[model samples]
Target: MNREFIKKLCEETHACVRILEGPIGTNDRIVLISAKEEPDLEISPAMDAFLRVFKHVNDISYGTGGSTDQIAAYFTACSVWLLVASQQAINLIGKQGSSIKSIQESTDATIRVISGA
Candidate 1:
């Protein structure tokens, strides 16, 4: 765990994309460790409780993304919620995805700013 990030609040409004996107600039991939297809009894009292408790995930490996940068990449695994949360995954796809062309357009613009284009 990163001691620096432990105290900081989560500020991600964009839905998380769990598939490994190779790597985020300088860090290794983030993985999902716990939360299985069916969680053990100790993890939850009911299915709904299990769903609610682990709705969001913490990164299991060190991810490389600038906390203060306008646009940065994050490399992490699918939270187990991703497997069960279709609506949530759809929401992320809607926000971060579209046609690849649209994503390319946005990334192109962002790259210009980074490269002083």
Candidate 2:
């Protein structure tokens, strides 16, 4: 829940997004083939780490009902990461477009709730 942790989460999320998008300048069709085979593979580690931290913060936030500011900030950061990750999924997984859209929408809603806007 510190600045350093938030920074690391953003960096990891960016890397996962890039991995989902595949290597640059590759054939789109071939990338699609590989993506179809392992749509959820590359982002698993980053997602796992993010979820662990997120759940920890959520549990603490609920248990204490204090530090609302800090908890809100952490939730906001996590929501941003989820938003970016889901958008990357949508961009990369053509065959699973609808599923990715749902993820993006869900993440967007979470962001709104966390940001109180």
Candidate 3:
């Protein structure tokens, strides 16, 4: 695992993406995790809780049986999408536009930003 790369990504995303080692029920599973915390904050309380709780009952892996590189890439892409979406919402609010057309435009812009189109 490229620990440095992941650490930097987590920092950039404000702990939105994390990696956990030896979670419960798995003999050996190093999982890269992402969850969108509602009522988001710069430091998400829900994210902190998620990192703490682990059990054999609820094991959430975005992509099971994937390599470390693939997991890292998935996490990074998700973080980028979140960032873009947040920005779009903020911009929409700033314009005082919350109509369906405005939302559609924001979504389109977010897609373009992430896809580099």
Candidate 4:
């Protein structure tokens, strides 16, 4: 539920997460960044799946008041799925270049928007 705990979980799972705490009356933000340089177009689809899962996780963590362990477990599952999706995207792309880099950034930006990062 707290920043440090979620951060630790993210690190253990090798996921890139940036938690931003806002000013008074503002809610904290959780951002997931891509570690890959040239992921495929499939990355967008993977991100779509991640967003859906994230919504459920958010509901459980903020709405239902799940335990720390439960949240941790759900996050772990999400992280694993994200990693697999990233890997799959990379595998599908297979090479790096200016075009691939452009696509990667585009996809990353799309993910950031969708994830509210």
For each candidate, what is the lDDT? 0.32, 0.43, 0.44, 0.44
For each of the candidates, the C-alpha root-mean-square deviation to the true structure, in angstroms, is 14.0, 12.8, 14.1, 12.6
Candidate 4 lDDT over residue span 1-117, tens digit each: 456755554554344555455446867444454433335543443343344346555655444333445455554343322323554555545565444567558644222111222
Instruction: Return whichever of 2 and 3 wins on lDDT.
Output: 3
Query: Per-residue lDDT tens digits of candidate 1, residues 1-117?
Result: 342232221221211223243345855544222322334443322332223223323332233232313112333222232232454545434554654346558644321111112
* CA shift of 35, model 4, Å: 2.4
TM-score of each: 0.21, 0.27, 0.23, 0.28
Candidate order, lDDT descending? 4, 3, 2, 1
The local lDDT score (0 to 100) that residue 113 gets in candidate 2 is: 16
RMSD of 1: 14.0
Residue pairs whose backbone atoms clash in candidate 1 = none
When summed lDDT is taken over every stretch of 10 residues in candidate 4, the lowest stretch is 108-117
lDDT measured at residue 15 in model 3 versus the true structure, 0 to 100: 53
Q: Give, for candidate 2, the lowest lDDT window spanning 10 residues.
A: 28-37
lDDT of 3 at 50: 35
* Per-prediction tally of clashes: 0, 0, 0, 0
Model 3 gets an lDDT of: 0.44
